[model samples]
Target chain A: MAKNQSEVSGIFTAGSKSKPSAAKPKNPFTHPLLLGSIFPLLLVVVWEVLSRLEVFPAYQLPAPSVILGTIAGMAEDGTLWGHVFITSYRVLMGFLLGTAAAVVLGSLVGFYKHAEALFDPLIQAFRSIPSLAWVPLFILWMGIGEPSKIAMIAVGVFFPVYLNIVSGIGGVDRKLIEVGKMYGLNMFQLVRRIILPASLPSFLVGLRSGLGLGWMFVVAAELMGASQGLGYLLVVGQNTLAPETIIASIVLFAVIGKLSDWILKKLETRTLHWQDRAAKS
Target chain B: MSLQLERVGRTFAGKPAVQDVSFRAEPGEIIGLLGTSGCGKSTLLRAISGLDNAYDGVIEINGKKVNGIQKTTGFMFQEPRLLPWLNVLDNVTFGLEGNREEKQKKAGRYLESVGLAGNEILYPKQLSGGMAQRVAIARALATSPEILLLDEPFSALDAFTKMQLQDLLLEVWRSYRSTMVLVTHDVDEAAYLCDRIIVLRGQPGTVEREIAITESRPRERGSSELAAYKAEILASLDLTTETA
Candidate 1:
C-alpha cells in the first residue's frame, strides 16, 4: 500500500513540476548500474565489520581489505601482469579456434542434410559427455603444457557455439530466403546476403555463452599443472594457506570476466541496433 | 518482357494446388489474378515467378523457358519482406549490380519516387506498415525488372493506405512500363489497376473466367464502370456469401 501510494505521488509530482519542453534529466540513483551496486557494497561493509570483530576465522574468510592489500602487493611485485597476460592469451586463442571450427562445422550441418545426417548425431553424443572428461585424454595426448590447456578450453567453448550456429542457420525465415530467390541470388549469394545476417543474432549469443565456458575451462585447464595464470595463483594460495591470496585471485577473476562480457555485450548491442526489441522500461 | 504460363500445375504431397492454369501477360500490361483463399492464386503466381519450378507445365518469359529464378523478374510478397538489418537505402539496392555510388543513387531516386525520400537511413523496424511496403515497392523497381510479380502486396495495409499504394503502383507502372502480374482477392483492386482480370476457381485451381476492363487509366475509384466490373467479377465467382 505504501509503495503504491508513493508511486502515485511520484507521478503527480513529476507531472506538475517537470516541464515537458525541458526534457528533465534522469535521476542518477535510479540508474540500473548504481542500483545494482548497492547490495554488493552493503554486503562488503557488513563482512568487513564482522571480520574486524573476529566473528569468523581469518584463515578461511579474509576481510575485503586484506584481499585488496594482497592484490596491491602482487601489483608492487610486478608478477601480477604475467599471470593476467597468460590467462587472457590462453582464453583468446581458445576462443578464436573454437569459434572458427564451430562456424565451419555448424554451417555444414545447418546447410546440408547429408552433413547433418552424418555429423549431428555424433556431435550431439559428444555434447552429452562432461566437458571436463576430455581433460585426462587431452593431457595424455598433448602433455601438461599450454597446448593441452588451450585445447581443453577450446573443447569447452565449442559445443554451445556449434549448437547455436546450427540452430541459427536453420531458424532463418523462409520468406526472407524467398526474397533472395526473387532477386535471383545464386547459392553463394543467398547465403552471403540472406542466411548470414539472419543468423547473426544467434551466433553472437553463441559467442557470449562460449566465452563463459572458456573462462570456466581455463580454471580446469590450469588445474592440469600450470606455472602461471590466476588459476595457478589459486593453487599457490591454497598450498601456502594464504586466504588473502585466494580471495584476491577470485576477485580478480570476477572483475576480468565481467569486463570481457561487458565488451561482448556492447558489441551485440551495436550490431543488433536495428532489431525491434522490446523497449527497456 | 511477356510472360506465358501453359498448363502449369503444382502438387503438394500428391494433393494438387493448381492445375492446367494457362495465361499470357503482354509487355507493359497489368494483369490481376483474382480468386478466394485456397483457390491457388498464390500458387500460380509462384510458378510464373519461377520460385517454384516443380509444376507440371511450362512458364516462359519472352518465349524462353524459365528453368529457375530469372534476373528479369521482380516479386513483392504479401508482407513487406525487407531485410530488417538493412536500412531503407540498402534494402532498395539489394538486387542491383553496380558500384556502390551508382546503386545508392538509383536506390535514392526510387525511394524518392515512392515518397520515402528522407527515410534512407531508417531501418524497416522504424517504419509504419505503409512506409515499409513503400520501401518494398522501391526495392522492386530499383532492379528495373522486365516483369514484376506482386502477391497481394498491399493486402496487409489499412484501407486508406491500401488505396494510396494501389495508386502509387499505377504511377510506377506509368513510369517503368514493366509487365505486372498482381495476385489479389480484392474486387475493387482488380477493377482499379488491372487491364485484364483472370479469375481462378476450384480445389486444383484453373482459369475460370477472364474479364477485360476497357476503362482507361485514372479511372474513378467509385465510378459506375468500376462498380459494374466489380459486380460482374463477384457474380462470375458466385461469391454471394464471400467477403474479402
Candidate 2:
C-alpha cells in the first residue's frame, strides 16, 4: 500500500504544480497491490468473518493476522532472506550454466550439419527425461550436496535453450547468407554477420523458454533435501502445518518469476526494438 | 582491369545454361547484357562475380582469375537483399572491414552520401524500396571492388524510382571509376545507362550485338540521341521500333 502511494506521489510530484494538467486524471485502479492482491485480501476478510462467525473451527483456518505473525516470526529469526537468497543463487547459476552450453551447442548444431549429426541424438535422448526424475540419480552421484541441486536445475534448463538455438540457426534465411557471400564475406563473416542476426528472433525465443524452465526446475531441485531456499521453506512449512509459511514461499517464487520476466522483456525490447515494432503491425 | 570471359560456359543437369558465352567490360564503360527470358544473363553475372563456380570459364577481374576468389567484386541482385537485421548505416557499411569506430564513421559517411542522412538507426523494413536500393548500392560501393556487376538492380523498382536510381548509378560510377556491367530487359533503361550495350540475341546468351550510347549524364527522356540508341537496341532484339 505504501509502495503504491509512493509511486503515485512521485508521478504527481513531477514539475508543474500550478494549474493541474486537464488531460491527466487519477486512475481508479492504479495500485498493483489493490489490483492483484484484492482477491487474496477479500478471501482473508471472508475467512476471518466466517471463522469468527463459527463457519468452521478457529484452529482449522487461521486468520490473516496469524499468517502475518508467522511471517514476522520467520523474519525475526533471519531465516527468510537466507532461504530466498540461496534459492535465487541456485536458479541464477543453473540458468547461466544452461544458457552458456545451449548457445554454443545450439549455434553449432543449428548451423553446422556434421556437428549436429554427432550431437543431436544424445541431447534428444537426455532431454526426453524429466528434471524431477533426475533428482534420485543426481543425489546418488553428488550426495545431496549443492552439486546435485545445481545439476538438477542445469539439466532442466538446458533443453529449451538448446532446442531454441538450433531452431534459430536452422530458421535463418538462405537468401541473406547468399547476399553475404556475394558481398565477399568469408565463412566466419557469413555466420557472424548474416546467420546470427537472421536467427536472433528464434534465439531470443529460446532464451525466454529456457528462462521459464529455469524457475520451474529450481522448484523441483529445491524439493530435494536442502537447508536454504524458498522451496525449502515451503517444504519445511508443509511439515509443520503452517500453510501461511507455505503461501509466503509460493508468493516469493511467483514474485521472482514475474520480476525476472519483466527484466527479460526489457532486455529483449532493447535487443529487438526494430523487430518488435515490425511485429506490432 | 577489364572483365573478360573466353568461351565461358555452364551446364546444369546436362542442359546448357550459359553456352560458350564470351564478353568483355572495359574500364569506365557500362555494358548491358540484354537478353530475352531464360538466356542465362543472371547466371553469367554470377559467374563473373566469382559466385558461381560450376562454370567452365576464365573470368579475369582486374587481370586476376577471380572466378572463385576472395570478394574482388560486388554483385547486386534483382532484390536489394540488404540485411534486414542491420540498420541503414550498418547495411551500407556491411562490406567495409575495420574496427568498431572506423566502421561506424565510414558507414555514416556512405549513408549520408546515399541521402539517407540521419536515418542510420532505421532498419531495412523501415525504408522504402528506393531507399533500400540506395543502401544496397552503398554496400556494393563500400567494398571498393575493381568491377561492379548489377543483375537487373532496378527491375523491381517503380519507373520513377528506376529512373532516379539510374541517374544515381551514373553519379556513383563517375566518382568511383569502377568497371560496371548491368543486365536488364528494359530497352530504355539499357539505353539510358550503358556506355556500351551488349545484346544477347540468341538463347544461352552469347553476345549478339553491341550498341554504344555516347549520350551525356542526366540525359533527357525524349532526346533524339537516347531515342536512337533505344531504337538500335530494340531492332537488335528483333523488336519493332513502335515501342513508346
Top lDDT prediction, candidate number: 1
Model 1's DockQ? 0.31
In candidate 2, stretches whose alpha carbon ends up further than 4 angstroms from where it belongs are A1-73, A279-281, B98-109, B201-208, B214-218, B235-244
Q: What does candidate 2's lDDT look like per residue over A18-92, in tens digits?
A: 233465676779656678888877888897788668886644556666666776777899887788788888888
* Cα displacement (Å) at residue A182, model 2: 3.7
How many pairs of residues in model 2 come into backbone collision?
A: 0
Candidate 1 collision pairs = none
Model 2, B1-244: lDDT tens per residue? 5888878888888888777777778887788888787778888887877677989868776576764745657788888888876777778778778797888887776666666666676677666677778788888887776788899999877776777778878887888888888989988888888888888755555777777788877778879989888877777787443243
Residue-by-residue lDDT tens digits, candidate 1, A131-180: 99999999999999899999988898899999999999999999999999
- Per-candidate fnat, comma-separated: 0.52, 0.32
Model 2 chain B: worst 10 consecutive residues (lDDT sum): B235-244
Error of 1 at A1 (Å): 38
TM-score of chain B of 1: 0.97
CA lDDT, candidate 1, residue A164? 97
